[model samples]
Target: MRIGILGTGNMADALATHWARAGHQVVVGGRDLAKARRLADRIGHRTGAGDLRTAAEHAEVALLAVPFGAAAALAGTLRDALAGRTLIDCTNPVGPGFRLLTAHGPSAAEQVAAAAPEALVVKAFNLCHENVWRMDPPVFDGRPLAVPLCTDHPAALALASHLTRDLGCTPLAAGPLGNAALLEATAALFITLWVGQHADAQAVAPPLSHAAGPA
Candidate 1:
């Protein structure tokens, strides 16, 4: 798969490295070409670093790893490049203070869909912490972590599922794109807990194992 990620941050580097290790072609882009290239060098992926449009154009699957605040402008830059392509929106709309910026009414992924009508947008990978994206995941009490996903497009969902599996994570289909609100809101809930505990806010959510439920 040709994966184009629109960020040079940890998420973009992590995913690009994993996919590249799994033998997929990966490219990462950002506003700073030098930063993107630095990340690519570290990840050792066959990557091309450039502006948003360049990355979007080179990918069959374009991932928006950008912060939600920049969603609108990034969407505009990626407009023509994203037509009929599967776009994975991994952003959460949190404010400068890490407060919820978007209402519970809709999710960042939905906003992306609205912004890019021609693209097939899917929401996934917003639940896990960047730490989980970094090192090889250790088993937590003998169970693997479940990564939730939501998308209206079956084909897009399948591709995401395969990619997640390749990264050694379980993919949970939490229904269509509309359900993305729950996923985004869940992140907010966890962040609140972190704030309350005075815990390290630098981390993302740790991978979670499913609890036993009523049979």
Candidate 2:
């Protein structure tokens, strides 16, 4: 797979590193060419560095690792280049107090889709911190982390699922793009519990066997 990462941040580094190590062609792009080059060097497998336009134009899948505030605008600019592409949105719109910044509007993923109408926008990788993703295989309590993705496009979802597996994680279909806000909200709540309360957010949900209703 040819993957384009549109950021020089932690998420971009962590995710791109995994993909590159998994034998995917990765292009790390950012506003600062030097930063992109540095990240590509750090990942150094089948990875390269380029301008944002070059990355988007050449990728089969594009990961929007930019900040939530900037993602929509960036997508708008890359609309043509991203057309008919699988665009993964890993952004969380959590603000101060761990509130969902997009509480009243469309989800960050939805906004990106609207901005790039021809792209297949998939919401994923927003629940955990970049450090968690940095973990080789991200397993805990003997279970690989399950990533819930929301996307209308089956092909995009399949591609995202394959990328998730590349990191040794599981991919769960969480519904269409319209349900992305729910995922974003879950991230906000989990982040609040993890950061503000020093709680293990994973412990909040019981295992499936225990979650079943009395029969």
Candidate 3:
């Protein structure tokens, strides 16, 4: 699949790298042309420029990897171009410095859908950190890392699962788009726990798990 990521941050770059390594064409777009070019060159895939519209316009699947607040802004900007396309949302709607902001209510995915009603918005990849995604995406224990996915479109959800598997993580369909609230809340919990671990200087979560227990 031709994957276009909307952010040039570590998360976007990590997905681009892994997707390119998996033999998929990946392109990155950001406010900084130089940064997008640099990441595209490093990934060794076809590169392009322009605003979010241009990036999302030409790709088969567009990954909304921008910051939480920025995601809705960018989606609003790309509203016309995103129609009829599958949008994989990886943003966490956290408050300042990754605090809970929008997870308790409608969730970031639903917000994106509301902002871009024509697009098929699916929630995925918000639970784990970018470092874990870049370095250790595979599960260490018996269970696969739980990357809960919620989407109303079956085709889009399947594509997300395929991409998740390609990137070395197991995908669990948490339900339809409305279930995004649960996933988003789970992401907040993960981030909170992550902060706690870093504060205590203990071992972080080895990988992700799809088990029934905690995040």
Candidate 4:
């Protein structure tokens, strides 16, 4: 798979490393060409660097790793280049106090979709810190990390799921794009618990057997 990463930040670097190592072609792009080149160099072989539009136009899948505040505008700018492409949105619009910045409006994913109407927008990878993604396979307690994805497009879902597995993580189908707000809100709550409360957010949920009643 050819993957385009639209940022030179931590998430972009972390996720692209896994994909590139898995034999996928990767293009790291950013507003600053030098930063993109540096990131590509750090990722080593099979990865290249380019401008944002060039990256978006060169790949079948594009990952938007830009800041949440800038994502919509960036998506609008790349609308034509991203048409009919699967765009992965890993942004979390959490403000101070770990509140959902988009509390009263569409989710970060929705805003990106509205900006690039022709693109298949998928919400994923927003639930964990980039450091967690940097872990080799992100396993904990003997279980591989589980990624929940929300997307309306079948192909987009499949691609996201494949990438999750590429990192040795399980992908949980969290429903369609309409449910993305739920995912974003969940992220906000989990971040608050993880950071402010210094709690293990995972403990807030019961095991599947328990949640499924007397199964």
Tens digits of per-residue lDDT, candidate 4, 1-215, equal 99999999999999999999999999999999999999999998769999999899987999999999999999999999999999999999999889899999999999999999999999999999999999998999999999999999999999999999999899999999989999999999998998999998889889887997885
RMSD of each: 3.8, 0.8, 4.2, 0.9
What TM-score does structure 1 among the candidates reach?
Answer: 0.87
In candidate 4, how many Å is residue 128 off?
0.3
TM-scores, all models, native as reference: 0.87, 0.98, 0.86, 0.98
22-134 per-residue lDDT for model 3 (tens digits): 88867688888888888788877455544556679877789998888888878888988888889999987777665678744687888899999999899998877787788
How far residue 39's Cα lies from its native spot in candidate 1, in Å, is: 1.1
Tens digits of per-residue lDDT, candidate 1, 1-215, equal: 98888998877877888888888878888899899888888888466677777889988888899878787568766788998888998888866565777774567888888888888888888866677776565245666677888999888888889888888878888899998888888877777767656676435535334234434
Give the total clashing residue pairs for model 3: 4
Candidates ranked by lDDT, best first? 4, 2, 1, 3
**Each model's C-alpha lDDT?**
0.80, 0.94, 0.80, 0.95
Runs of candidate 2 with Cα error greater than 4 angstroms are: none
Q: Which stretch of 10 consecutive residues in model 1 shows the poorest summed lDDT?
A: 205-214
